[model samples]
Target: MNYNGLFTHKLDALKEQGSYRHFLEVNKSAQHFPNFYYTNEEGVKRSAINWCSNDYLCMSTHEDVIAKLSFVSHRSGTGSSGTRNISGTTIYHRELENTLSNWHKKEAALLFNGAYQANTTTLKTLGKHIDNLVFISDECNHASIIEGIKSSGNEKRIFKHNDLIHLEEILQGINIDQPKIIVFESVYSMMGTIAPIKKIVALAKKYNALTYVDEVHAVGLYGNSGAGIVEQEHLEQEIDIVNGTLSKAIGVFGGYIAASNILIDFIRSFGTGFIFTTSLPPAVCAAATKSIQLIQRDDSLRKKFHENVLLLRKRMEENALPFSVNDSHITRIHIGNATQCKQLADDLLKIQGVYLQPINFPTVPIGNECLRIIVTSRHEPKHINHLVFSLKKLIYGDDTHNREIFSALSVADVENEA
Candidate 1:
């Protein structure tokens, strides 16, 4: 058979599994809120209320951030021109790193082009230093962490999601003398559930292992000054390394790892991802620095963010939508089957103007297809009502076919109030 035919066959398989992804072209610019305009394949333009973006605090289109971008572009130019070890180490980059380190209360911080590169490079570099390194990771960690651990070519073990007993059992079973790293995210993106971070950090200490916490989804959105989950829980000093991203809540592009000065220096000396790639643009660095300062000073934003999350959760509960348990603003509406989930998402977009992307395998497990509705700070009560009304119509319709699942609303209510 021709190779072209085989490639087509693979594409067909993806279609059959409801896993094929197509990019939607945005005709208009993104707003400060969770809505944007897009042009469809039919060349028709439409406004869509987006519930799939990770812009939790809706800072991406803030006037201040945009103005800072403009100011930085005019002053320092665009690209960093080289790697950080080379010509990329501009004054803007240094200032941004310093700001981040101060925010997280870490001794130092180093920047990366993106969070994926940051996690992968940091894990790989740190893993190489220890002999017989054992990595204990959550089974539901993001793809970046999974790839990083696998690339390290070290012995690894995975525990059930948020199962502290399982994790401790594995830790106890492993040889205590060998170096280990307990890797996990502060917030599990897909499930919207927060890890038992303080407990995990304690376990790491008991095992004499280093802790690596990924705060990509939590940073610049949690704590008093948006320092992330560690700060929210007041466990900043307990975590060994904290990985974060500027592209999310900071509304800019780039990633960074905050740790002891020695660890940051170690990664700088050996991490191939940092040593090889061009540094973030000078404008991007400046934008991030400004955004960080804004987040630190803006307590009202965090309060509004939490209020929006509570409002959305309450509405979803009232509508009797099936959802996972979560403490954060991220909410996953479980649609069960893959095809139905995709159809539901498409219906929400085309019929109701809601643009929630269907998350299917392998982002989730084979049977755990869901519509991950990310509620941002900018979403108002009217938006929450609109989502609830549309979802209720689609899920319940005239008949009560989903009564069993609808009964789960009480659980969501309790969880939300908790």
Candidate 2:
């Protein structure tokens, strides 16, 4: 078999369709971020401003967080050196889990290696253990959720994104006594849209279904204590399960699911992903615990984060850029075509030192390609202004030149609340 030829053919197809992913090697500078050093495809180290970082509050570089991480790593060894059941459960892990459960106002919490694993393993365990379990998920759910539900070999129903009416119709078809879970996200990162969580919760109650909300993008960035959207919207007691990531907004590394003690125990005991995989290192748990404490005590970081978000949206609006608004800390500058989206990103990185990755299929549907920007608290007005100015020059061309890198965008193709 010409195995290499087959692999190359498939990879070439990805490049042809512009769906191939090329990772940029970057080193973020604590003193000057948004501005970072990145090694390009040509192996040249270049400076660039990042507008797509998931470090919402920049807590990863916090002095106290770093101190705790270093302290733990020095006291303990570097690695856990075992799975959770085999000498991997340290005091740091227990402390972090306890802190998380209290923060989410849940009876218990179970730690996972990553948020993706948390979702996939938790859902898989629930589906496999519960007889006749059904998952009614949002169509726009992350790939991890889709993979888990599909892997369970259970019946899966997908409703249109945030469409309560369609969701209810699907629920009505299922038996009232049937065990079902409504899986969705608190914030759609790519489009900067907030879900109708309250309405979805109501539907779940009416249908006697469990609710699972992925708070990966919302935790440490919402609520008074940085609990997440449930706490922010006063739905903490209503949500059955909340899966969150320490890596994103928390600015650490790990994932957890907050739930009732019974459900938590069940997953921890039976989940293959949790039972067999190695646990998080002591330093990571310590750093995450410290970061969570910081977020709870400080609101200035979150305020600055929202301020930067508003500044960015305002700048884009002033320049008549085609972008969508969901009153969140994300800006989705719509370019429509995948090829054009990649071109815009490349031009911005190469010519203006601005960096943002393009969102394309199958991450998003065709014709919905765009550049998703996530501004952190560290980003200032100058960075926002630079980004807008660079985007305008590349997308709209300067007065001296007639360079048109993108086609004319139609009102229908663009989704703007400007």
Candidate 3:
């Protein structure tokens, strides 16, 4: 058995299946967000409007977040220096944890390097520690949750995405005396569909199972204070643990779990992923704290982001371009074939200056390939119009301009009325 041959075979299989990932190099400017510079295959620098960035609220480059980051970096130097137990815990970390706990209305919060770390560690730890822990997970949950559940060697059952009946059936089948946990996500990122948090919480209560809700995508875009869908539905208290990321909506690079003090302390003490890993930098924690503070104080950013989503949806509808329909801000255009998905993304970048990275298999199921479009607060009406027009022409071969689509609408006009 040749190790080199085995590795080559896997690479060949991926390439042949059109599932190989090629990351695009993009540099976004603080001055002109939503517009970025990317190098083409020929090494030519091209400008494009970003359509797939996870910087949902455009807070990554916000002045307030930048100021906090710069100040924290200056004061603390660079890295956290070691793992949390060693010399990593700082005033900023404690402050950020406090901010998170307050936001989620939880008893305490624990920081991890990222959402993947938090979810994986928390789930595995709970499964390992609890007696006869049974995991009931949503079928469409992100890889992080599934991996965490699997790694724990727990008895797991997967319910259909957002299918409460299926979930209830599984819950009913489990013994009432057995310890169990329900794992799901607030927002299914790839398809842009939201989970039914209230009903799920109710079921968890009836079955006496712990509930873990991953709100990575919803944290900065939903609810009164951008706490997440749980907050929006007034179910924050129902969830036993809430896992969130600072990378996506918060525009920083970290993740955290909000829960009761004992649960958090238990994870901190027992979870290998938490204990072995270096903590996130002080600057990242500070920036995330500032981002949360600013977002909580002002609902304007979330409103503006939704307005952009509406504008994009309206344009796509007017153009008759096929895309996934959901109330969430995500816009997913179907491209069933993987090769076609890749080609479509390349064509959009090279021809129309629209940069949306193609999402393919393992991230999403094969034959369900699609282009995920994330419209941010920084995207104007013109950008939305142009993106719709370009997508129509490239995908549907509808190049004819429909003046009615633009319709003299601007984000500023919408904001002014608000």
Candidate 4:
């Protein structure tokens, strides 16, 4: 049997398809954020502006967060050493869970290694234990949610993205007696569109289905206290489970689920992903807890982030650059072709010193390949204008084919699709 030949052939196929991924190694200096050093294709180290970081508030570099991490690490050493059930759980983890539960106004919270594990394990556990369990999911739900639902080996239906009517139709056909769950993400990461949280929760109530909302993208950036979309919509009480990640806006590393005490206790007891994995380090948990506390008290960070979002959008519009026009902070420039998407990103990084990772297939639909730019509070007006200028020149340059593709997309249509 030529096992090596089979493996090589598949990898070769991916490279031939222009879908092969190559990660750009970067060293983000503590002194300068949004600006980092990366080696170009020619092996020359260069500085570039970051536009793809999920650290929305720049809290990952915040002094308070760093202080907590330093203090906890110095006091407790490094690793958590084992799964939570064994010796991993600590006061840091417990306190963080308490903070998270209170922030979301939930009865309890259970920490997971990360949001990926939380979603994957919790959904799988729920589907397995609940009789006649079925999952109704958003078409564009994050890969984690999709994976968890798939692992459950239960009946599942995917409705059109953000189409409440489609979701309701699917729900109505299911036998009312069967246990069901509606799983979705609060913010559609790729498109920057917010889910219809209130409407979806209302439907879940009408259909008597459990509601699970992954608020990974919305958690540190929305609501008065940064709870999430559910909080913003006043539907926090309506959502059965809310999943969030600390690695993003919270600007640390970990994930947790906020829910009723009974539901949380059930998942905590049975979720294999949580049960089997080593818990997050005490220092990381402590830092995350501090970050959350700081963010909840201050709106300046999110306000500054939104200002940057608006500035970038306005700059792109003024230049007539093609990008997804959504109300959310995510700025997606549609490039359509995978090769072109990578090329644009490479050129921006190497030549213009603008760094935004290209969004390609399986992260997004093939024809929808684009640059998912994330503007943070650190990006100034000059940086935004420079990005827009570089993008305009590169995209609208002598490449008539690329120009035609960009011209064909109506910004209005993009917004409507969102």
Q: Give the per-residue lDDT digits (tens) of candidate 3, residues 1-418.
A: 8999999999999999889999888887978989999888898889999998899898899999999999989999879988999999999999999999999999999999999999999999999999799999999999999999999999999999899999999999999989999999999898788999899989999999999999999998999999999999998788999999999889989999999999999999999999998888999999999999999999999999998898888888787675677768778776666877888888888889999998999899887777899999999999998998888777656552322232343433322321
lDDT of 2: 0.89
Candidate 2's C-alpha runs over 4 A off are: 41-43, 398-407, 410-413, 416-418
Model 4 clash pairs?
none
Worst 10 residues of 4 by lDDT: 399-408
lDDT of 4 by residue, 1-418 (tens): 9999999998888777677889989888756998999877788889999899999999999999999999999999889998998999999999999999999999999999789999999999998998779999999999999999999999999999999989999999998888999999888899898898889988998988999999999998888998888888888788999999999999899898999999999999999998988999999999999999999999899889988998888888888776777767888877778888887788777768999898888898887888999999888898898889888877787853446656667777665544
- Compare candidates 2 and 4 on TM-score and give the better one: 4
Query: Per-residue CA lDDT of candidate 2, range 89-179, in tens?
Result: 9999999999999999999999999999999999999999999999999998999899889988999999998888899999999999999
Best by TM-score: 4
Q: TM-score of predicted model 3?
A: 0.94
**Between 1 and 2, whose TM-score is larger?**
2
Residue-wise lDDT of candidate 1 within 329-388, one digit each (tens)? 778777657777787777778878888888898888877777888877777888889998
- What's the TM-score of each model vs. the native? 0.94, 0.96, 0.94, 0.97
Regions more than 4 Å wrong, model 3: 398-418
Every model's Cα RMSD, please?
2.7, 1.9, 5.7, 1.4
Worst 10-residue stretch by lDDT in candidate 3? 400-409
Clashes of each: 0, 0, 0, 0
Clashing pairs in 1: none
